[model samples]
Target: MEKTDVEILFEQIDNITETVQQYSNETYLDSLAVTLEVIFYQHPPEGMDEKLQEQLQNFIPQLDVSKYKTTEIRKALQLAMLKGMKGATQQQHLMTPETVALFVGYLAGKVTAGKKNLRMFDPASGTGNLVMAVLDQLETAGSVFASEVDPTLINLAVLNANLQKKEIEYFHQDSLRPFLLDPVDLVISDLPVGYYPDDIRANDFELKADEGHSYSHHLFIEQSMKYTTPGGYLIFVIPEFLFDSDQSDKLHAYLQENAHIVGVLQLPETAFKSEKNRKSILILQKKGPNTTAFNQPLLVQVPSFKETKAMDDILAQMNAWFAENMNS
Candidate 1:
């Protein structure tokens, strides 16, 4: 069978990374600049919000599009970007894996049925892949909002959004800070993983009251939970250590007191095959002040990619679990 558009796009994107890497004199920065130029022309800034268009207009340089077709340009844009965001510059900068991306869509699709025009947020949206995943899974349209701690990575996020012709206004700052932002329906992110230094401002959150303690993934979880609407769902890709780690005892208590741990999915080992870190996706639905945990959360394992029956089986279990527990 002929290659699908997605397959072709992936191949072309790989070509962009290889080609850019091979350029003896070209910096990845220069290659990145070229990629951004291509993205803007391929997905014109017209019809975008005036402020967004104005912000985008300031940066989109005219490029030599005569060399490659529009499809190739978009792929090249993706390729260069994938290469640019290499590793954990911070937890916010970790590259989301393709398998996890697929699972994110699956997880979202399971619960979002019959809902239309939702609003979503990813606090530490590394290149906004989770944001992309949620939008892709939704049957109807929705708005995406995300914040990235890294300025450079946020540029990549903007470029990717332009390529997809999606509107996303990214806040470039620390997500841990208690900024007065609107509570969104769906809150999601692959939050920063390891310990945070005292100067990072994560300790500023009221939950991190212990001046002697160093904040880490636990802080991200707490802050994101607060950011989500009381009835909204907060999804995170967190370390397996979070399940019973001494470090997160306070976090666990807070979670027990305030939120409903909706779904715990053991991600496949390949979810972060590069770094080989054991991680899981934690789906929590925030609760109102007087609310008590009414439903027992579901804990399921992600099936292997080769397991033909895995995804369907996993989702089926979740569907039954949600039917019993979602609003109970």
Candidate 2:
């Protein structure tokens, strides 16, 4: 059987990435960055060992960038990155599942429908996979922005966007820090869960804990809200225990004052390895003059993606709900 586009592209990426990893003695993640950089520039950088440079020069011409579609390229890169991530020890290093990214893209497209030349931002855009996935489904994406504090992730992200010919402005700083950006039309993130270690920075946020370190997920919501345009939508993959934590009361009150709860879709438990790791999608629309709280917020229990009939039925109901509730 002939290889599919994604499979072919993944093989190409894996081959070149492995070549660089083995030659340069770098981690798989770092070597993937070098692989993408060389691919994007169409040449190996200067100051490399002569043999490694010669090897990369040979590989460059063989990669026909124009032959692959953007989605195929993105998927291929995602596969290679996932391989790199297997050795990652930190929780923050994990990428959002492709299934969840696709679901978020669908929701983003639905919520922002009819809007043109939309500006989008992802505050915790690790390696740019989720943002790229969302942009693939958007009809009127205007300017895209993403922030990441980790140097290695940011480098991979820039190369990832460049190889796919995506134009994005990136901030290589802690996302919670202030950005010189104008408010954006939409915000999305797989919010990093755990306590934020910066007590001084924590003091600057309304959701900061009363005594100890602030919950990073809660602080992310506030920070995302601050940068989103009024009436703009924000979607997050949040821990199931978000509202049950000790800081829940403050978070609830803050949301009441600033945004409307649009929906909560409990992701299928089968998506995660354990119940404690399970998460839900929380959708919000920042409070504005033109927006009002929905009388019936969209509450859904998402069916497993493999259950085609059940998934189709749920999506149909969701479409009806959006048409009726969002038309106003």
Candidate 3:
């Protein structure tokens, strides 16, 4: 008997779970675990065949399904497929569906009261997943512009945009370099980490202690502020080390003095495969002279997932919090 699409998906999930379980240390397993969880949580694709199902099932015995939420498992599987399709090496760090969903929900909350036709920008849009997520939540009048340093990633992002039927203006360039600054209502970026492609250059003035000197994140934050409108928001996924490091102190201080630090979401180590334990999302809004003050940072520390219910509960909590603090 032929298996159903849902059955194939389930088998795929099982295979991925097995793969994750095979590794003694949780960190050694592929980051696909998060992708699999996201897939199950969101829309499950249809029409998978038995052959594909069997191939996916091959990896099930390696994962520890008990350690992840259902949504996370689905996301992990989806991410693994995406990586496979892209021919990415084992070292590549692909964004999971859960990350995208979380970002989308945050963007949705950030612009709830803004103009109907918002302008959005992503400085380092890899595969366009983050931009697509933002586009999904914006109004029909919203427009998106994105830049990817890698030509291959640009091609993939273009394909993704086409698949989603989203209207986006994409550029192949290093976003960190100086360029024609366009005014925007929102800027959402996931800055690169560790080693980047050869074409990317560090700013001349910004110096790194271990790495070579480049323009600091302070420069990036300043540049972002320059292009954003007074009431616009800037959401960034930064390395956790930078978030609280001394180098980041000035940026945080600047944000506190000039902008409103709306929220800070500390992601799990599993959020990005490359950095291990240092990654977080900083949500900032450019404040005008009249901007009101909030009591404390809307900080959320998401726990490691081991079940679908946990993921759903986390999402619900985040959504409720956003709704409650819409103005902040």
Candidate 4:
């Protein structure tokens, strides 16, 4: 097949990024920011100047800024920047895989697509891929909101959304607090796991005080639910160990009593292999005053889906679970 404009632009941008990466300097981030600016925007943003343009010349030899539109440039820049994050040792941001991102987003869209109105939020929306996926399917799904603490990643997310002319109600602060004034219909995230700083949590999270001090993931789950509307859906791509820990017992109990946790699908170990964590997708439907007596969630052990039969079994397990709970 002949290469399309997107394919050709991405390849050219890739070559430029590879050259830029070889320059081992403390000013790497600044260089990258300027590189993106000169390529994407005709005017340097506010304080930046033509000197920033000099930085680009060394990396991209045959600069044809006129060849691509601003939107196309932004797309290539976003792709290059994210690729750099995955490869860099220092300041690396581990993004969720595209398949997983699309899966969760598609599932949410499938449920809420035809609804008259709906809102979706992601607590830790790295690169905005998850929200973008949701928008891809549920094109009519109302507004999108997300929070990211890291300055760089948040900026990338904003740019990615804007490139496609999608508006996001973005908050640059931590998503742990009561960020949204109004509760949303759906919450979707790949929650970040690590030790949350104690002094930070010394405020309102007295409920999970101890458990949160150990792992911030617990706090994210509890806080994420707080932002959701009653009977709203909460979807997370999180570690399997999130439920296994003794500290998480309270969370498990609270979810069971308060939400109809319809599915707990153990993702194949191959999903996203990091040295420390195996992941799972938890699908939750918070109960309202009118919700019926809670239903038991389907819990299934998935296999390594190397071939046809294993993949079939995994799908079968999830389909059976969805049949019972997607309505509740």
Candidate 5:
């Protein structure tokens, strides 16, 4: 009996995984990992009925899976299977498609209003969802840079970019490390909170087990400002608790001293219900020394969006704010 194409592909994937595992360090692992993920997602191996399998065999070339690692290929296959098993029930809590639409709309409004030449960065880019959103709204001239610590999640993000046929630079790095290069025009990140898989030591004074080890929304905001050019923007998704915490006071003080609090959008709980987290979008402007005379912060409290109408209301307000503030 002859081996099926699926079996052959699985064998090829295994070979790639073994090759990647041969490398002791992370660099090779990261490179092969992302490539493997892209291949797996592009031609998932699981849950394909005989008809679907035959269709895929014709559509997907056998040579395409040669460049990636087997582990990454397997992981992608597993993810697809898991998602299928959970089905529609898993999607209910996910951020509504409209939420992403509103976000892109707001981003478009900003870009149209002289936020051009935009150099965007997301420090904690997860599966490249927000990064993709920004790219979809901006022009081809714009550049996006993203960093993710989790190798598996980073692979997913790279795959997402490949699926979109977009060019983005992604780094596999711990966000807490000091960036060696200069800042970009904009920094947008959805900060990780509570317990996360990739928590790193906050600083030399902190231990990895310390509560401070987790990436803080305040830290991302503050550190990101350092990388942002004066008059540039830092847009981030943060936990609501950040607004009222002692850390918030410190973050506010830092912003008062270094940047302008441009706006805050209180996202619906549904926005992050899938992740079981509460989130808010904050838009901040890095101020130049000459522009630092403003005495206070601009506080805008946006209501939660429960449906399309609510999202429309939010988009309108965000568009209005961009029109009033951003110059074309």
Candidate 6:
């Protein structure tokens, strides 16, 4: 049988990344970045050894990146990135699961339905996977933005976005810091869970703890809200214990004052490595004139992905709820 586009592209990416890694002695991810550059530019960058350049030249013609759909391209790249991430030791380096990203995309599409030329931002765009997934689901020709603190991750994200022909303005700085950006119509992020190390900078945030390091996830929500236009929406994949932590009261107060909790959909336990890592999809609308809380917040317990029938039933219920409430 003929290979699917995603399979073909993943094989090409994997082969190129492996070849680059062998030649340059770079990590799998960094080598994949070089591979992406070569694929995108159709040539190895200047200063690479002649043998490696020749090898890359031989590989380029075999690639059929342009013919594939956006989702296929994303899937291919995501598979390659996931392979690289296997050897990574840092918790922050973890990629969002494709299934979760797709679900987020679906919810985003539903909320922003009928909107045109909307602006969106993702402050924790690791390798651009989640944001690109969201972009694929959107039916708008709007501005997109992302930020990341890690240089290697940001470089990969840039190359990933470029290869996919996504026009995203990226901030290669700490996402918690102030950005030279206008408030956006929507914000989405798979929030980085942990305590933020910078207490002094944490002082600038309303969600900052009164003492010691602040929970970075809390600060992320506040920062996302800050850059979301009044009446705009923010969607996040949040830790299940977000509202049960020692600092939950502060976060709760902040949200109550500034945004309305539109929904909280608990992701299936099977999706996570452990109960400690379980997360939920949280939707919030920034408080503004003419905006009111939903009559009944959307609260769902998502079924496991492996259970197709259960998943479909839950999605139908979600669709029905959205149709009833969001259309008004």
Query: How much lDDT does each candidate structure score?
Result: 0.66, 0.92, 0.59, 0.67, 0.57, 0.92
Q: Candidate 1 residues 1-328, lDDT tens each?
A: 9975555555544444344445424555444544454445644334534554443344334333445543444444554556655633434545667567667776666555556787778888866666775666576547778888776677777777776666777888777776557877777777677666665475466456465555567788777777777767778888777767656667877888778877788887765654447788888878876445654677888877667687778777777877776543
Q: Which candidate order results from sorting by TM-score in descending order? A: 2, 6, 4, 1, 5, 3
In model 3, how large is the Cα lDDT of residue 124? 73
| Residue-level lDDT tens digits of model 6 in 1-328 | 9998899899999999999999999999999999999989988999998999999999989986899887888899999999999999887899988889999999999888888899999999989899999898898839999999999899999999998899999999999999999999999999999999999999999888988899999999999999999989999999999999999999889999999998999999998878887889999999999898888999999999999999999999999999998884
Instruction: Give lDDT tens digits, candidate 2, residues 30-129.
Output: 9999888888888898888898898888988889877889999999999999899998988878898888899999999989999999999999998999
Best by TM-score: 2
**Candidate 5 wrong stretches, greater than 4 Å:** 1-105, 195-201, 204-215, 274-276, 290-310
For candidate 1, the clash count comes to 1
Residue 117 alpha-carbon offset, candidate 6, angstroms:
1.0
Off by over 4 Å in 1: 1-30, 42-80, 85-92, 198-200, 209-213, 274-276, 289-294
Clashing pairs in 5: 16-70, 17-70, 183-227
Any idea what lDDT model 1 has?
0.66
lDDT of candidate model 2 versus the reference: 0.92
Predicted candidate 4 versus true structure: per-residue lDDT over 1-328, tens digit per residue: 9976656777766654444445524233434554454455543355533553355555455556457664455456556665667555532277676557756875686446456668888888876777776676676678789888877778767766655567788898877766745888898988787767765653465336553364567777778788888878888988878877767776777776777775666766676656365778887877887765435666666666565697687667666656665553
lDDT ranking, best first? 2, 6, 4, 1, 3, 5
> Which scores greater on TM-score, model 3 or model 6?
6
lDDT of 5 at 15: 48
Judge candidate 4 against the unseen true structure and give its global Cα lDDT, from 0 to 1: 0.67
Per-model TM against the reference? 0.78, 0.97, 0.64, 0.80, 0.65, 0.97
Q: List the residue pairs that clash in candidate 1.
A: 91-192
- Model 5 Cα lDDT, one tens digit per residue, 1-328: 9965445655554444434334324343343453355354665355534554454455446547445453333334333323322333322112223354357436544744555566778887756666666665566337778887766567767765664566779888877677655688878776666433445345431222345343355556666777888877777777677767644555666667776776666665665544446666777778875443323333444455556676577667656656665542
Model 3 off-target regions past 4 Å?
Answer: 1-81, 84-93, 96-101, 194-212, 215-218, 270-278, 305-320
Clashing pairs in 6: none
lDDT of 2 at 215: 94
